[model samples]
Target: MRSALLHVSVPFVLCVTLANTSLFDEVKVDLAYDHYAERRVDYLPSFLAMPCNCLVNLAYIYMGLYWLLNCRGVKETEQGRYMREVFAFMAVLYAPVQWVRLASLRRAPAVLDQWFTLPIFAWVPVWISSIQRRPARWRAPGAAVVQLLSLLSYGLSLAHERGFEVALGCHVAAAVYKGACVQRDLGDGRTRVYLLLAVLSCAGFVVLKLLDHWLSRYWLFQRLTGHFWSKVCDVLQFHFSFCFLTTLTQRAQGKTASQEE
Candidate 1:
C-alpha cells in the first residue's frame, strides 16, 4: 500500500499542480465562503472557518481506518487487500484535500479537491473489474490502467465551464453501470443491499452538494447544511462500495475453492 501510494503521489502531485495553473483556468471551482451556505466563524482558523462542513471530513478518516484493518482470507487477502487499502487510503487522503480547500481557499487545493474525486469514483469500476476477471494476475495492471485514464480524464475540464461535471458524470455512470453488471452476475441478497445503499449514497452525495444553497433556505439544513450532509453521504458510499466489492470477491474465492476441492 505504501509503495503504491508513493508511486501514484509523484504524478498525482504533478497533475494537480499543473491543473492549479492556467491550464485549469476555465474549470469551475468554488473559492469563496459564499459558495457554501454554512456560516463561517471569524475567530476560527481558515481551515475551520466553516466548522460543520469542515469537521464532517473526519468521518472519511474514521471510515478509512476501519476498512484499512479489515483483511480476510489468505487467498482473498493477497489480491483483495491491495484494492481495499488503496480505496481506504483514498478516503483518508480525501479529507485533507477538502479541508485545505476550506482553509486556504486556494486554487490548488480546490483543483485537488476536484481532481482527486475522479479517481476515487473511478476505483469503483476498477475494483469491479478485478472481481470480474482473473484477480491474482490482472488486478494490479488493470487498476494502473484505469486509474491513469481517470487522472487524464480531468483534462476534459480544460475545455469548457462544465467539463468537470461532464467528466464526473462519466465516472459516475461507469461506476453504476459496472456495479449493476457485477451485482447481476455474482451478488446475493446481502450484496444486493450493499449495492443499493451505495447507489443511493452516491446519488445523495451529488444531490446534496448541488443543493447546498437551495437547501440552506430550510431550517433543517441551515446549520448542518446540504454540503455537510453531502460529505456524510460521500463517506457512506465509500463504506458500501467496500462492502459490495469485498463481498463479491469473497464469494468468488469461495466458489473457486469449492471447485478446486
Candidate 2:
C-alpha cells in the first residue's frame, strides 16, 4: 500500500534525477568540474553529488539523535540505556567525522576520512555485544579498545603506504563479522528474512562499489554509466541495511517487553 508505493517511487524518482545529472562523470583531476572526484556518495551520489553526501551525513546525525531520544522514552531496561548511550556517542562522533570527511574531500586527501572512519567502525563490536544480550558494562569499553587499536593500526598502515588497503580490509572484515553475528543470532523466521535481505544488500553494496572503480573501462558499462548505476546501488543498499537493522532491533525490544509483562 503506502509502504509499497514508497519503496518503488523513491528509487524511480532517484534514478530519473541521477540520469539527468552530470555528477557521475568519470573522475577528472580538474577540481572545478569534478566535485565527486574520488569521493563516495552514500546514495545517489551521481545526481545529488556533494549535497547528497552532506544530506546523508545529516540524516545519520538526525537518526542517531532521534533514536537516542526514543530510547529514553522506553522503559529503562539495561539494553535500552546501553542503546541510548551508544546512539549518543555515535551521533557525537558522526557529526565531526562527516565534517572532516567533507573537508578532506575539498582538500583532496583522505587522511581525515580514514581517521574518523575508525571511530565509526568502533561501534560495531559494541553493537554486536548489545545484540547478543551481553552485559552492558562490557560494550563501551570493548568498542573504545577496538577503536583505539584500529586507529593505531591505521596510522601505521598509512606510514607504510598501505593505508587504504588496511582500511578497506578492516571495513570488509567488520561488515562480514557483523552480518555473521546477526545471522547466527536470528531466532525467528522474520529475523531470518531480514538477515537474508541484509545479506543481499551487503552483496550489492560490494559489487556496486567495485563496479564504480573498474566498470568504466568496459564499453557497454561506460555507455550505461557505471558510476551512476553504482551510486543507485549504493542508495538502495544503505536503505535496505538500515531497514533490516532497525526492524531487527525493534522486534527484539518488543519481545523483551512482552517477556517482562
Candidate 3:
C-alpha cells in the first residue's frame, strides 16, 4: 500500500513544484513597487495582478478535485457520512468566499495585505441550515470543531498582517483532525494508514511554516520559494497516500464479500 501511494504522489509533486516556480516569478513581479503602484491605478487589473490571488484560485481548484475524487460516493460507513457532511459544509462556505472574491477584489491578497474579513457571515447561515438537518451525532462536537477552526482562522487573519499563514495553518490542522475522525469511525486498517499519512503531510507543512517564521530576513522571498517547493512534496505525498489507501480498501472489501459468498 505504501509503495502504491508513492507511485500516485509523483505527478502531484511535480505539478506543485511547477506551480511554486510560477508563483515565485509572479510574486517577484508583484513586489516591484512601481509596477504595483501603476497597476493599482486600474482597480481591475491591480486586483488581478496579485500572485497570492492566483495561488488561492489554484488552491480552490485542487480542493474541488479532492472533493470530487475522494469525497463523492465514497462513504462506506456512518463516519464516512460525517466526513462527507463536513466537506459539503466546506464547499458551501467556499461558495460565498469565491463569490466575494469575484465581486470585491477579483484578485488575491498578499501574505500581509488586509481585505474584507467578515465574509464568513454571508455563508454562516448556509452552514447552520445544513447542520440543523444532520444527525445529532454529527452536530455538536464535529460541527463545533469545524466551525471553531473556520472562525478562528478568519479572526486571526483580521488581527495580523500574516493572516494568510494563520488561515493555512488552520486548514492543515482541520484536515488532520478530519482524517483522524474518519479513521476512528471506519476502523479499516488501510484507511487508518492513509489518515496517518495525511496527518504527517500536514505536520510537514507546520514545520516549514515555523521555520519560515523563525528565520525571517529581508530577502525572505528566496526562503519562501524553497518552502513552496517543500509544500509541493507534501501535496504529492498526500495524493499518493490517499489513492493507494483507497484502492487497498476497495480490494479488501471485495475479498471479504467474495469470501462470505
Candidate 4:
C-alpha cells in the first residue's frame, strides 16, 4: 500500500502544482486591486492555501489507498468485499468533490459548494455502519433511514436559515447513535481507545467549524490563518473518521471470530 501510494502521489502532486500555478495566475488578474480604492476580492495567501490544499488532497489519497489494501483482506464474504470496494470508491470521491468545489467557487454561488460535500457527510456513517454490522437486526435499513432524515433535515434547514445547525445536529445525533451501538457490542480492549479518539475527533471538527465561521467574519482572520485552520480541521476530521470506522470494524470481526470459536 505504501509503495502504491507513493507512486500515485508523484502524479497527484505534479498535477496539483500545475493546476494551482494556472489558478493563482488567473486569480491574481481577476482579483486584482483597483487603483481607485475599490474593494479587494477575497483571497488568501497563495503560499498558505497551496500547501494546505496539497496536504488535504494527500490525506484523501492516502485513505483511498488504505481502503484498497483493506479490500484485499475482506474476501471472506461477497458482502464484505462489496463494502470494502464501496469504502475505497468513497475515498476516491473526496478529491474530485474538492476539485469541483474549487471550480464552482471560481464562478458560481457558494451554495454549490455544499452540493459536493453535504451528501458525503450524511452517507459516510451509513456506509461505515453497514460494514461494521452493528444494530444487527436492521443495520442496513436503519443506517439508511438515519442518513436520509439527516439529509432532508439539512436541506430544509438550509432553505430556511442557510446555516449548518439543523443538519449538523442530525449528523451528530446519528454519529452518537452509531457509536453507541458499536460500543455496546465491543468487549473491553484497546479498540476502546480508537472509539474515544473518534468521539474527540468529531468534537474537534465541530468546534473548528464554528470557530472558523465566527472568526472569518472579521478581517483580521483573513490575514492570520482562520481559513487555513479550517482546512486543517477538515482534513483531520476525515482522516479520523476513517481511523475510527476501520478500527471499529476490525473489533467487530474479532468478536465474531471469538463467538464462533
Candidate 5:
C-alpha cells in the first residue's frame, strides 16, 4: 500500500514543485510563524517551530493507520476495499505534506497541501457511488474520473483569487449533500450517528481553521490554538468517514449475499 501510494504521490509531489502557488491571495496559507496562533519555540528545530500545530499532524497518520490496518471487522466488495485503502493512503500522505509546509514554509509544499485536499474531499461522492450499486469493474475508472476533475479544479486558483475556496466549498457541499441523502435513504441509527459526527467534524475543521487568528484573543485558544483543534477535527472527520463508508459497504454486501442465496 505504501509502495503504491509512493508511486502515485511522488510524481504528483514533483509536479507540485513545478506548480505556481497562491500563498497570499487565493488560499489561506500560513507562511510565517506569526500566521498561526501557536507561539514558536526558538530552541526547537524548524520542523517543530509551532510545537502544537506540528505535533498535531501525527493524528492524521495515526488515524489513517488505524483504518488501513483494521480491515477485518467488516467484509466488503473488492471495489469497496479499493476505495477504503485509497482514502486511507490519502490520509497517510496528507500528514507529511502539511508538515513539510509548516517546516519549510515554501511555495511548493503549501501549494501541494491545498491541491491534495480537493481530491480527498471529492472521494466522498465516489464512495457514495460505490454504495449505490454492486461492485463493478467500471467503479475504478469512475473514481479516477472524479479525482481527475478534482485535481484540475485546482487550476481555478490560478485564475481567480477565491477560486480554491469556491472549489473547496463545492466539494464540501457535495460531500455533505450526498452523505445526507444516503443516510436518509439507506442508513440506520448507527450510520446516522456516523454521518452526523462526520458533518460536525467537517464543520469544525473549517470553522476553527478560519477563526485561528480571531479566536486567539480568547484565553482558551491561546496554547493548543484553533489550528491544532482544527486538525483534530479533521482527523475525526476522516475516522468517521471511514466508519460511515465501511458500515454502509458491509450492509450492502450483506444484502447482496442474501439476494444471491
Candidate 6:
C-alpha cells in the first residue's frame, strides 16, 4: 500500500504541475527547431516553455523512491561501491562539459545551433562500471552482438542527416539480439514480462523515429528537435536495457543459490 501510494504520488504531483505549464509548446518549439540552431540556447526560455525540468525532477524523485523500495539490492556492497565510483566520475565530467557547452554558445555556426547534453552522464558511467566490475558469469553471445550493433547505429545516426534508415536497421537488429539475451537470462516467468516490456519499448522508438521523419519537412524551424528526441530515446533505451539485464542476472544468481541450498 505504501509503495503503491509512493508511486502514485510523485507522478501525480508532476502531472499537476505540468498541467499548468507551457511545456508542450516548448517541446513543440524545441522539436521544430532543434536541427537548425547555432549557439548555446538559454535554459530559461526552454525551461519556462517546457515541463522537461519538472519531468526530470519527477524522474529523480521516482528514482529515489525506487531506491528506497529496493534498498536491499542497492545496499549490497559491490553495487554500492560501483555506484559511488560512477557518481564521482560524473561529478568530475559534468562541470567541464557544461562549461564548454556554455562557452561555445557565444559562437554559433550555421550547423550548430544549440548544443545540449543529457544529464544521464551521471548514471550511465556508473552503470557501465558496475557491468565491468561485476561481470556476468553466463556471457550471452547475443549481448555482445547487440552492443556492436548499437554502436554501429550510433555511428549511422552521426552520418545520416535525414531519415534513420541505416540506424533504424541497426537499432532493430540490436533490439532483437538484446531481447534474445534477456529472454535467455531471465527464463519464462515474471522476469520475461520485464524483458518483453523493454523489447516493446525499443520497438516503439522506431515508430517515433518514423513519425519524426514524416513531420520533418512540414516544419520550418532552424533547430534539430527530432535529433534531440532521437538521442533522448537512445539514452532511455540503453537505461532500460541495462536495468533489464542487471535484474535478470541477479534473479539468475538467486535461483542458483536456492538450487545449491
Top candidate when judged by lDDT against the true structure:
1
Query: Model 6, 179-250: lDDT tens per residue?
Result: 565466455676566556656655554554445545455553223433334434543554455465456546
Order of the predicted models by lDDT, top scorer first: 1, 5, 4, 2, 3, 6
Which order, best to worst by TM-score? 1, 5, 4, 2, 6, 3
What is the lDDT of every predicted structure here? 0.86, 0.49, 0.40, 0.50, 0.84, 0.39
Listed in order, each prediction's TM-score against the native is 0.94, 0.56, 0.40, 0.61, 0.92, 0.43
Per-residue lDDT tens digits of candidate 3, residues 78-184?
Answer: 43333333433333334334334433442343211211222222122223223323332235454445444454454454455565555655455444554454445
Instruction: Kindly list the per-residue Cα lDDT of model 5 for residues 68-179, writing each as its tens digit.
Output: 8789566666677777888898899899989999999976778788888999999899888888767643456777788889988887887886788999999999999989
Q: Locate the minimum summed-lDDT window of 10 residues in model 3.
A: 111-120
TM-score quality measure for candidate 1: 0.94
State residue 66's C-alpha deviation in candidate 3, in Å. 5.1
Writing each residue's lDDT as its tens digit, candidate 4 over 1-261 gives: 443344334434543454344322321111112211212234744222334433455566677667667557443344344444444544665565454433333422123234324545665566556656633433555744653464445344334554445565666667667666766665245545655665676676566545754665578654433444554555565655666665666666666667779
Best candidate per TM-score, number? Answer: 1
Q: Model 5: which residue pairs collide? A: none
Q: Is candidate 2 or candidate 5 better by lDDT?
A: 5
Model 2 regions lying over 4 Å from their true place = 1-56, 84-109, 136-140, 202-206, 213-261
Q: What's the residue-level lDDT of 105 in candidate 3?
A: 43
Tally clashes: model 6.
16
Candidate 3: C-alpha lDDT: 0.40
In candidate 5, position 95 carries an lDDT of 94
Those runs of model 4 whose alpha carbons end farther than 4 Å from true positions after fitting are 1-55, 74-76, 103-109, 116-118, 124-150, 187-189, 213-224, 257-261
Q: List candidate 1 stretches off by more than 4 Å.
A: 72-75, 136-139
**Total clashing pairs for each candidate:** 0, 0, 1, 0, 0, 16
